[model samples]
Target: MTITHTKAMRKDNTLLAITHLSQLLHYVTGFGGFIVPLILWLASKNDVEGMDEHGKSIINFQLSMLLYILISIPAILLFGLGILSLIFVGILGFVLPIVNAVKAANGEAPSQFLTIRFIG
Candidate 1:
């Protein structure tokens, strides 16, 4: 009886781990396309513990999208200035997410500026 129980527990744990990995897999496998929570829902329907790294990475990924949108506004101010401004922000956006994705894949929490807001 004890041996069977232990095996079942291990199976459950493995299932949970796979689920967590799948949630954050977007950071590793794509151009931040799976950065949204919708993709992470494969593992847990409610929430999964010990996966803050993935959440932080996705948050940073979303912030990069915001940077792209913001730069487009300034890019409209002047043709050359807009192009230069976008190029700068766009580069930062690309680099930051890639770094964060690596950190996330390694199960490390990374700090991303302005991405996490204190609601309380």
Candidate 2:
């Protein structure tokens, strides 16, 4: 039983090491760019020790990018000239997740890039 669990643990972490946002975001944009964050969030939620903290931090940061897109779309549509604001927010949304994911790999937690702040 213990051996089986260890094997599973190794598999999960191996997958995560390669499954960071940089690979996912570029691959998953058409599906509303939603799954990337969701998968990372779930992984983070379940990750063990060091990985768990890294996962949670990545999840939180990606969630922020999701929120930024959700909010800025309305802002851009609200008034025709909101294009500039939309462009700015859109760039941040793309950049933050990648940055946070990199930071997480190095065992650091960055500020949320989106809605709320619940993680340390």
Candidate 3:
């Protein structure tokens, strides 16, 4: 017979909010936005009350923004419309994480605007 000990999950609004805001790492260091939160989430999802949901939202938003930016690159040829999309993506990427960070701090579900359900 074998017994396993599992850590109990707990509610931590501060950690949640920080995870949401960590997406900004991409802007500050040109990377780590996804990596940081991803590591945090994977490390604590089972130990944190809302880490799974919030983490997924963050990942989805990051991925969607990346896809939009990638598409916008070649779109620079289409009369510069890609420029507009790129700007929009940049603004959205910067804004949504902040908004969702506030929400996460308040124990509200993080918003996944324009996010594609890639993980589930």
List residue ranges in candidate 2 displaced over 4 A: 1-28, 50-71, 77-81, 118-120
Runs of candidate 3 with Cα error greater than 4 angstroms are 1-6
| Candidate 2 lDDT over residue span 1-120, tens digit each | 355554233224433443445434543555534555446546555544345555555555556655656666667767754566667666765676566556555655544545365555
Reference-based TM-score of each model: 0.48, 0.54, 0.93
* Residue 109 lDDT in candidate 3: 95
Q: Is candidate 2 or candidate 3 better by lDDT?
A: 3
- lDDT (Cα, tens digit) per residue for candidate 3, span 25-86: 98999989999999998999998899999999888888889899999999999999999999
lDDT of 3 at 26: 87
Write candidate 1's Cα lDDT for 6-103 as tens digits: 22111123333343344344446665344444355334433454344444445455655566658677677775787776666656555655565455
Better by lDDT, candidate 2 or 1? 2
Model with the higher lDDT, candidate 1 or 3: 3
| Top-scoring candidate (TM-score) | 3
Rank candidates, TM-score, best first. 3, 2, 1
